[model samples]
Each structure stands twice: as C-alpha cells, then as structure tokens.
Target: MSSRRQYQREFVRTFFTSPTAVEGDDSAKMLRSASQLRGMQAPDAWIPDNEDATAPSMREEGVENIVEVVSEHGEEFPGEIHPRIVWHRDDPSTRYEGFQQMLRIADPEAGAVEHVDGFVIPEVGDIDDWKKADEFFTIIESEHGLEEGSLSMSVIVESGAAELALGDLREEMGNPSNNLERLFMLVDGEVDYTKDMRAMTPTGELPAWPELRHNTSRGASAAGLIAVDGPYDDIRNVEGYHARMEENRAKGMIGIWSLTPGQVVEANEGPLPPETERWLLDVGGSEVELDDVEGGQAYDGTELGLEELDEGMYRLEDGGEIHELDEEQLRERLVEMVSYVPSMDDIVDSMAEFEAAKEAGRGAIAMTQSATLVVDGIEVEISTDRMWDEATYQAAGTPIALFRDVHEHRPDQHDELKERYGPEVVERALDLDV
Candidate 1:
C-alpha cells in the first residue's frame, strides 16, 4: 500500500498496552491482557515507558525491557516497540532529552539498541516541543537510514497548556516526515490534577469530563492525530473500568492504555461492542419509540442480520417491502434505538468481539459533540474537530477553564497567548471572568 493510505488506515483504531519498563516484561503483560479479554484482540502495539516516573534507567532501561520482551514473547506479542521520550513542562528543559533518547536508541554500537519502531513525547505543550519533535524526525531520516513515513510517532497531551495550544501545534505540522500520528490526552498517570485538571480518577474516566471531551475529540482529531485515552489506575474495578472505557469510546477516542497485566482485556475493549442482535439508531429524545418512526429503525427490536438493513437506513425483512428512506426523511423520523442489555459475561464477550471488528476495520461508532462548557464561568463552544470553537468560545456561561489552567500554571506563556488570540480576549477570560 501507498504511504498516505497506510498512514490513515493503521493509526485509526488500535489499543496500546504500556507495561512498566523497570520491572516485568511489558510486552508479555500486554499479551496477557489480550488473552484474558474474551475477544482476545491482541494489541496493535506496545509502548514501553521511559519517563522518570515508570522506568529506572530512562530510555536505555526501556530499550532493554523491549529486548527482553521480544526475546520471551516474540511470537505472541509482536507489536511495535515504541519508547516514550521525556518532555515534562516542570523539568527545566526535557525536550532536549528526547533527542538524546532517540540517539540512545539509534546508537547500535552503544549497545542499548532495540528495534525502535516509533516514539512518544510526553507533556508536549509548546512550539519548541514541536521543533524538537521535527528534529528527531530529521535525525532518524538523515543519520539513520529510514523513511519518515515508515515510522509512527505519538505525543501525549498532559498539561492545560498542551490542551490550549493544540491548534498552534497542529499548524506547525507542515513537515510530512513528522508523522506525529497519535495524540493521547492523559486521563490518568502522574498528573498534577490541581494544575491541569480537577479530577483524579483511577478509572479511565476524566476528573474534568468537559475538558477531557474537548481535548480527546476536538484538539486531537482536528490536529490529524488519533486520540488515545489514558489508563485506568485501579485494575480491580472492572465495572468502573467498563464504564470509563465506554465513556471515552462514546467521545471518539480510538483506544485506551494499560499499565498492568490484568487491565489488558478491558483496556483493549474500551467500550462494549455493537450488539450483533441489536440495531443502532439516533433519536429525538430518550423516550423515543419505534411505533410511528420511519425505516431508520429496526422492526420491534428483534435480531436481524446486519445484511437485513441497508446501512441502518431501511429494513429488509424476509418478505417485507424495501422500506427505503432518503437521508433527510431518515433524519426526520430517526429515534434512539434501545440498546440490548448485555449480561456481565455477555459484556466480556461483546467487548472482545467489538475490539476484533474494530481491528478488522468494521467497528467505530460515530461520536457526539459537547454542547457547551463553563470556562472560567463563560460558555465556550467546542468544535467538531475537538478544538475550541474560537468564534463562539467566549459565549455566555462557557467556562474557559483550560485557558485559565494554562494561565495559572505557566504565567510566563501569557505573552504568547496574548500574541496569538490578542491581549483583550485572553485578559478578559483570565483576569475579569475568573
């Protein structure tokens, strides 16, 4: 396949199991995660940790972890070995360390070498971070013999500043070799909740739901990056885990991450699957019924072969007439199709099946958009691409909390904000509103 098509296709929907590099075999942990899950949808890739928090020896220990992983679980967990580079804002300057980390991976004679399929830069918030990312691409393509497109790169959205600067960061991606495909918003992990967000759940759900929704859907999607949901901390909370995964999936997140062996299955199956026996349809209200509804719905909620429906626009009953309807007519009459309730065991199986279909390129339900958010008490509209709808962001009751969070955490960057969106708008939201 050509590069462009392959690029868009492979990155769309894939779970990543991030095993701690300092301790056990991360890849093996991921394999176990997949195996335990009913669908057993093996992960698309395994990203080993190299950040200060997880691994002991930094990037070198991470590479060693991958080598051991390939040695022990080569046949079973043959996903890509992508190491994360440190880019924490609190650090004086960690972006430069990212380059060093890449060098450590590329330096085969130095002996910390492993197959470096890709890289993930954590806590990326500014233009300098983008420049550092670009430089990494240049070194891999120029010094090491590799096509930039032949590899995939990811960036984590961890800070309020990163959340706010997503647009500027996107425009900076003029370089084709950047290949910064995955944009994971950190839902959990060593996050300073007081600064970046207000919630701190061990489950995959966000502390601040509205902000999380905007970042995962608007900023990440609009930036042409696949949005990955973060890990759920408490591995024992299976019910909470399922709920969090379902919530993120509803918001257009392609996948979530796993830290331990047990989280693998539920982590991979972020949301439960599309009920094979059920029909999915939108509706005017929660109380919508099928009686007077047009053909956009299933007849009486009985299980019909997916082939029985023409893309959910009409029905194909055994001897019934083709109840065809146009898009406009379908829209006019469409009502929420009641979801089939799945038992606990059924959920386990369905999550796996849903994961399989998504991997096979047949899954991925559409996501809905947020209506409004209270940012510093003012309402801000979140755009479809998942970025702040700037024109209407300052609307009444839309809270520009992310903006305030950025301003509060990093006051030095206020000048940059003033320069980008003008001093008046930034000041009004930050100073007067709050």
Candidate 2:
C-alpha cells in the first residue's frame, strides 16, 4: 500500500505573485496574499504559483517569497501547500533552475520544509520524463535527510505524451526505486495541452476537451489519486462556473483549479452532497413538474408521464401509450423516478439506521422514502423502497468520509458544518466507522 497521506481534495487555489510591489506598498503582492490565505477556509489545498502566474523576470524572487512566506505562516495554515515549480519537457536549463529552487526551499534548515506538502510539476511529457522528476525529488529528500517519499508529487497533464503517460503508472509502480506511489493528484492543464496538440478553434478559445477530462478521471481512479479539472478562466461567470462544476462532478472529477477565493468556496462546496433533498425528472428530454399536476399528467412516480389510474395504481403515459401499474409496481416505478441525491443529513441518518440494524444482528434491510404532493387540493403519495446491504452501505461511505476528512484537516470549516448539519450530526459523522 502507498504511504502517502490521504485527505479530501476539493479546491486547489493557485496564489500568483509578482515581483513588482504595488504603489504605496513596501512588499510584493504575493507576500500579502499568502498571508491572507493562511486564514481562509475554502481551499483544501493551496498552490504557491511560480510558473505561469509569475512573470519570468521575477521567478527567482518568487521562489524567495515562497520560502519566506511559507516559512513564516505555513505551519499555521490549515490546507496542504504544494508550490508549483518551473519545469519543461524538452528544456534542461529550466528544469535545472527548478531543481536548484527545490533544493533551497526543501533544505531542512529552511523552516518551510516541514510545512510544505509537495511540489506541482507542470508540462510533463511522458513516463520517462515523470521518472526523471521523481528522481529529482528522491535526491532532494536524501540531501535534506527527509524520509524517503516524504514529499508527495502532483503533475499536470498538459501534453499528449503526458496524457498517455498516465496509463503507464501501474506498471511503473513495481520498480523498486520508483516513488510513483507517492503521487497525489493528476491535474489538467488544457491551455498548454491545446498548444501542444496544435489545436485551434474559430474564436481562438480553448476547446472543452471533455474526453481529456474523462481520461484524467479514469487514470486517477485507476491509480487511486485525486483528479482535478483545469481552471475555468471566466471567473466572473459564477453560474457558468457552477455549471462546469456540475459537469466535472458527473465525470467523477470533484476537485477543480480555483483562480479566486470565491471560486475556492464554490469548488469546496461543489463536491459535497446538497444541503437539502432534490429530485429531478426528465420527460421527453424536458424537465417537468413533480409537485404540480395539470392536463392529467404528472411525473411524481417515474420518468415517464404518470397519471393517477386508481387508488393504488398509476398509468405510465409516453407518446399516447399507456401501461397500468399496481401498487407494488408503482412503488418500484417510484424508484426509477427518484433521481435523488442524498443530503448530508440523509446519509448520516441512513448510516445510523444501518448501524442499529447491524447491532440487532441484521445483515440487510429495506429503507423506504416517501413524498407527498397536493395537486389541485388532492393529496397524492409517492414512495420507493431501497435495499441497504453491506454493499450499499459501503457505497454510501464517500460523503461521510469527506466529512470526516474536512473535520480532521479543516478545523475552520467546523462551525460552518455544524451550522449546516447541526453539531450532533457532525460529531456522529466524525466518530462513525465505515
């Protein structure tokens, strides 16, 4: 098994710094922002960006700023800090400079070494290129007398070769000298990737290469590492950002590159289950009302248009065809209509109920959820029964695991969780066993 530290990875906010000081200020902008991030609550991981975010002329000073600020306040920062180091697939001199900076920053004498989690290497090419970087890290650890594999590594899939390199990690893990197991996240960098591919668009905008995102997620899952999507540059479009997050969540990519603190908050809360219950239905590719009924059609019981047939029956109507369903059949149909994403409270309640059942010597049980709607002043009931076995319980463990990780790593978010889920539920979640 891997010895790398595992924690919830939701938001990665890159702190960009410039060498030039703002007018009327004595220090660089990066120092001021780094100090501010020490107290922020949203970013689960912070990246002190020294690559694209910093001007080429100021990179040396940028490294100094990282060493100074991180050494000063990193111990108090709640989030994991991974500084983005300069690197290139084809250039040796740039990689050498990055190595020298790593040596300086990771020196045991530097107070920042203990607080630094790892480094983010960008513009990676292939598996060989990856191993070269790993060797560099290994040498750094030995030079500073740090434990082997003590510092984790995350890489950006910015080139086609890097995209293909992800598939080779499992095989490479067997090498005795390889520290592939210490990898943490596979982050997407679409801008450079587009440049690498020589791809273009009519409007000169980066194409949404969804296949790349999916492959990144699949690769991360296979390697048991976190997958983070590329940054969304349209920061002002909050709705668009949320929409992108929804798409990423569907692709099993829960973490995102956040450019601002507000984006960090959005990404931090994006992967978590909703605060309240939500059920949606798609009828003929259109969303129809579930609570209100008109024209003798409603979607209360299934994705197909449902109409009340009798006291305990429903008619499944689609394109003028009808099929009658009895009470038991309608109950099963309701299960199909339940496009339900469980709330945090709902998950905790289910886990608690299952634990009680286990204590009573039961291996499995059926959990029932019901919904009541009043249409035209007449009450209608919709209900579904789901089997909760060991498998089901294990599958439901993600949200609970995330909650526990947050409680353990992000103490600043504790009060927010308490306010959202109440102190009792939060406490139980932290104490519960999977």
Best by TM-score: 2
| TM-scores for the candidates | 0.53, 0.84
Instruction: Tell me the spans in candidate 2 whose CA falls farther than 4 Å from its real position.
Output: 1-27, 38-40, 283-338, 359-361, 375-378
**For candidate 2, lDDT tens digit of each residue in 355-384?**
899999999999987675433333446666
In the range 18-67, model 1's lDDT, one tens digit per residue, is 54353454533532343332222344445656674454454566555555
Cα TM-score of candidate 2: 0.84
**Which ranges of candidate 1 are over 4 A from the true structure?**
1-41, 52-59, 67-78, 90-93, 107-115, 175-190, 197-206, 270-272, 278-434
lDDT of 2 at 395: 79
The total number of steric clashes, by the backbone 3 Å criterion, in model 1 comes to: 22
